[model samples]
Every structure is written in C-alpha cells, then in structure tokens.
Target: MAKYELNTKEQHFATTRLEAEAIVTEAKEDKHLIMHKIAEKHNKYGEYFLVDLTFSYNTPKEIMGVE
Candidate 1:
C-alpha cells in the first residue's frame, strides 16, 4: 500500500460517505422528509459528521439559532 498525507479538506471529506446513490435519488423526489430521516439515522448511528458539517456550513444561522 502507498503512504498518504492528507490535508485538512481532504481529511474532512474523507470522513464523509454516502452509502447509497439511491438514497440521494429518493431525496431528490422528497427532499424535506428524506433528508430529515437521513439526518436522524446518521445521528443515531454516529455517522452524523458530514451531515453536521454540511448543515453547519449551509445553514449556520438556522443551526445556530441566529437571526
């Protein structure tokens, strides 16, 4: 195996994985409900890092309860 030295962005992205492309397609049809269910599942199963980062970046005000 080759050695690797990942930078910060690579490290963060490396920790995120989407298990199934189908789930993404499903979310495309019903974004609100499917994404909520996915978030809950990731939280419960301890794979919430990516979703957390995405929401934190994309919805900082909403997540942080700011105005």
Candidate 2:
C-alpha cells in the first residue's frame, strides 16, 4: 500500500491514495482549503510511492486574532 501525507493547516496521513484525495476534497468543501502542492516519491521498484499534499487555509486576520 502507498502512504499519503496531507499537509493542510494541519498534517494528516492516509494509507491509500484514494483516502488522501478524499481528505483533500472534503477539506476543500467543508473548510474551504486550497490545494497548494502535490508530490509523489517512488521507491526503487516504482511500485509504491509516498504522496504528499499541501493545503492552505486562508483566513482573514480579523478572524484569527479574536475568538
């Protein structure tokens, strides 16, 4: 199985690519996160690779300083 890493406002990991994709999609819809970057690194055989996704959550400064 392949390992998936999602680096959003927080970091998350998945055991499969589909799960990682789903997590990003859900975050996009529910949290309004933007996709910043995606990368995959393969092993020697190229049979498995680690997927990394970076998501950015853009919140206004006004919304962050106060509760």
Index of the highest-lDDT prediction:
2
TM-score of each: 0.20, 0.41
Model 1 weakest lDDT span, ten residues long: 5-14
Clashing pairs counted in every model: 0, 0
The TM-score that candidate 2 achieves is: 0.41
Q: Across residues 1-67, which tens digit of lDDT does each residue of candidate 1 receive?
A: 5333221111121224463334444444632332322233344546533232111122444534643
| Per-residue error (Å), model 2, residue 32 | 3.5
Model 1, runs deviating above 4 Å: 1-19, 31-67
lDDT for 5 (candidate 2): 39
Model 1: lDDT of residue 55: 17
Give the alpha carbon lDDT tens digit for every residue of 1-67 in model 2.
Answer: 5333333555565556776677666666655355433345456655332334446444455345654
Q: C-alpha displacement of 20 in model 2, angstroms?
A: 0.3
